[model samples]
Target: MSELSVTTRSGPNGPVVEVAGELDHDTASEVRALLSGLELRPGTQLVVDLTALTFCDSSGITVLLAARNHVLAAQAGMALSGVPDRVQRVFRILGLDQVFVTYPTVEDAVAAWPQQTE
Candidate 1:
């Protein structure tokens, strides 16, 4: 299995977390911790870019849900971008596709992020 890596970058609306490689039970905690530590503002959006994700398991999905919950608890929005087709299918089967907003690319998600009202 490929080693999982989670990296964060500043986004137009907030922070972007890019996850690469295999996301399974072994590495889910790493991602969960990082997400839990983010400082988000009410109008900001947390973008999780999974473009380079090679694989994901149930634990990975749980971490994703946790990320969503973290953002919501902070009064921020969350989106998933560049989700692999395999994972997309699983999301659909689990009805998570309805729970999470998704974009075909990171750029698209950023463009669609709602602007903060002054």
Candidate 2:
């Protein structure tokens, strides 16, 4: 079993959460709790960095979806960065690739955020 770790940081777009772990059923609730505890201001663009994630199970996928819903409920934006190729393949296989917006890096995700309207 791989250990789970999540680090949160403030960024120009919003709060960026860097996740490193094997996200399986055993660890998904912890991740979900971390996400649930966040208070995103309106329009904040949340980015989840998954570059160090080694594995993700269905429960992990559910947690990710929950994160997305949380952002939406707060009227904020959310995206995933640094998704591993295997994870991407799994998402595609599950037809979840279309449900998520992912980028190659944090910078890319930040750059793609919708500019604040004047």
Candidate 3:
């Protein structure tokens, strides 16, 4: 199994989380914890880049939901980019496609984010 790794970077839209490796039961908690720690400001857009993700399971999906909840609680928006076909199919099958905004690339998501007016 590929080990999960997460990296973060700040963008004009908000925080960009780059996830690599397998996102399964064993590593879901780590993802949750990392997301929970983010200081999401109201209207901030959180983009999760999954371009490097190799695998995902139910637990991983749960963690993604948790991240969305976190963003919602902060009055922020969340989007997923670079989702693999395997994972995207699961989201479609579970009807989660309507729950999160998806983009073909992280740049697309960021560009689509509502700008925070000064």
Candidate 4:
């Protein structure tokens, strides 16, 4: 099985979590834990970068949904960036394409974030 790596960095809008390698049952918890621990605030946006993700199973999908819920509960927005075509197909098939807001690049995701009003 391919190893997974999940890293986070501060972005202009909020936090950007970059996930690389396989995201299957074995590694889904790692991603979930990190997401659960994120300090998202209202009006902020969270972007999950899946550009380097090579594989994902049902467990991975569940974790992504959990992340979404976590962000929403914090009153923050969320988006997925650099989704692989294969995964997109799966999302489409499951009707999850409608559930997630996706972008071709991380920059696009950040740019799409709602501007905060002073």
Highest lDDT among the candidates is held by which one?
A: 4
Once superposed on the true structure, which residue ranges of model 3 sit more than 4 Å away at CA? 115-118
Per-candidate clashes come to 0, 0, 0, 0
lDDT by residue (1-118, candidate 2, tens digit) is: 5698999999897899999989999899899999988999887898999999989988999999999889888999888999999999998998878888899999998998875211
**Candidate scoring better on TM-score of 2 and 3:** 3
- Cα RMSD to native, each candidate? 2.5, 2.5, 2.7, 2.6
Which residue pairs show backbone clashes in model 3?
none
Ranking by TM-score: 4, 1, 3, 2
The models' CA-based lDDT, in order, is: 0.91, 0.89, 0.90, 0.92
Q: Where's the lowest-lDDT run of ten residues in candidate 4? A: 109-118
- Give the candidates in order of lDDT, highest first: 4, 1, 3, 2
Error of 2 at 9 (Å): 0.5
lDDT tens digits, residues 46-88, model 4? 9999999999999999999999999989999999999999999
Error of 4 at 45 (Å): 0.5
Model 2 whole-model lDDT (C-alpha atoms): 0.89
lDDT of 3 at 4: 88
TM-score of each prediction: 0.94, 0.93, 0.94, 0.95
Q: After superposition, how far is residue 30 of candidate 3 from its true place, in Å?
A: 0.8
